[model samples]
Target: MKKGLFIFCFTMFIAFASKAQDNTSLPAKYQEKMTSIFNKIPEVTSSAATSLIDFAKSMLGKPYVYASSNPDRGFDCSGFVSYVFSNFGFKVPRSSREFAGAGTPVKLADAKVGDVLIFTGTNPRVRKIGHVGIIYSIENGEIKFIHSTSGKAHGVTVTEFNDYYKSRFMKAVSIVE
Candidate 1:
């Protein structure tokens, strides 16, 4: 009985070890997946950007509706950003994808509050910028932003730009300056 148990435990250990190795050394099928999973701001970068971010944050909990730009009626991702920035006196593109080309392109590491963060859709083949968010802050190496999502949260909310987002990240556009 003791010998049998030892063999069983050894087999289990080998199985788990191999699984861990697989994860650490992601195979070809997971190379893109790993890149997405593995994959910041400035100052004078002051009041205007801060105000815009604050305004967007204020709209948190508002419903997310497709193609609507009115805050009270609810807003889609781009609409929410458009509405907020318009209130602050900047004209912006009406769609998330359009914003990809609207402002000066900034490296992801150089993003600041009020910058637009563009992302591709969840599908690997979809390369278009399908979502947008306004940068709020970067803290402890985590970039957080505000946007209205049709996602599980289903409304305007602040979210950490984590691994899932990294996978979809397309570009960052600086609109405040």
Candidate 2:
């Protein structure tokens, strides 16, 4: 009887241990994994990110014209991004899709202000990158970006990485050292 009781107690302990490990929330586990992955990438200083962000902001209120890079005539999503980065003397890819594979990819959680945020449409029917933007800020742990959108806003604007974009977010690429 003592041996049977001991075996039962051991089985219960194993079950309890397994349950405790499985109890970890998915979000917490994801967060932990992201934190570790982000740690490997070099840190992006705020000053560097701010410099690129400032340039993008300077064109705020500019109209959004498809396939146009002319700031005076208005800028499209990729055009605006390429234009701004060109000013920094970096020749970036011309299309949003091209930009996706341009720089060293940094995870979204590790993205800094200057990192490039790629996205598909708000509805996200497509798997290709259709839009590009520069990370503008991280407010209250939320990532925001400055992009020229052809949406209702219809111009260069700063937007929070809310549910709309969050669901569409592809990945972030660090163009600046």
Candidate 3:
């Protein structure tokens, strides 16, 4: 079963790698970085990934509170991610910026449930990791993530990885194994 999963993930990685080659919006250097990161994703167990995702989902609709890691008082983006991973005994970084180098990077197209999705701050012009989320699902080619946002949703919500997010996407990472 593990071999089968690894094969499937590798095949998906190859397909996405080819597609990534055509994307010219991101600079060549950044593309290389992403590819390097994608190559380092470790084999992840589905059960663990599912458990983490389920725990994250249970917090749906929780209010968004900046700089907070407490579920009772709400959570900011990184705080929410930190809270979830910590529950599973994973010592993840506490801040979004710190996550850039936390775990093995996974390609966005190959991101799986429980993977961490990192994004630039609200202003895409500033290329720095300022937001984070947990991948909830990828259905029919549409990737959806669960995150705590201060946007229109105003709280912990599942959001589509649409153009808005794509523009700000920095990298995805896998911390579960």
The Cα error of candidate 2 at residue 154, in Å, is 0.5
- Could you tell me which residue pairs clash in candidate 1? none
- Candidate 2 deviant stretches above 4 angstroms: 1-45
Candidate number with greatest TM-score: 3
* Local error of candidate 3 at residue 137 (angstroms): 0.2
Candidate 3 structure quality by residue, lDDT tens digits, 91-124: 9999999999999998877888889999998998
Residue-by-residue lDDT tens digits, candidate 2, 1-177: 999999899789657645555434557757667556445434433566667778888999999999999999999999999999999888899999998789889988777778899998656867777888998888778988899999988999999988889888888999987
Which regions in candidate 1 have their CA more than 4 angstroms from the true location? 1-45
Better of 1 and 2 by TM-score: 1
**If ranked by lDDT, best first, what sequence of candidates would result?**
3, 2, 1
How many clashes show up per model?
Answer: 0, 0, 0
Q: Taking the tens digit of each residue's C-alpha lDDT, what string does model 1 give over 92-117?
A: 99998799789899998888777999
Cα-lDDT of candidate 1: 0.83
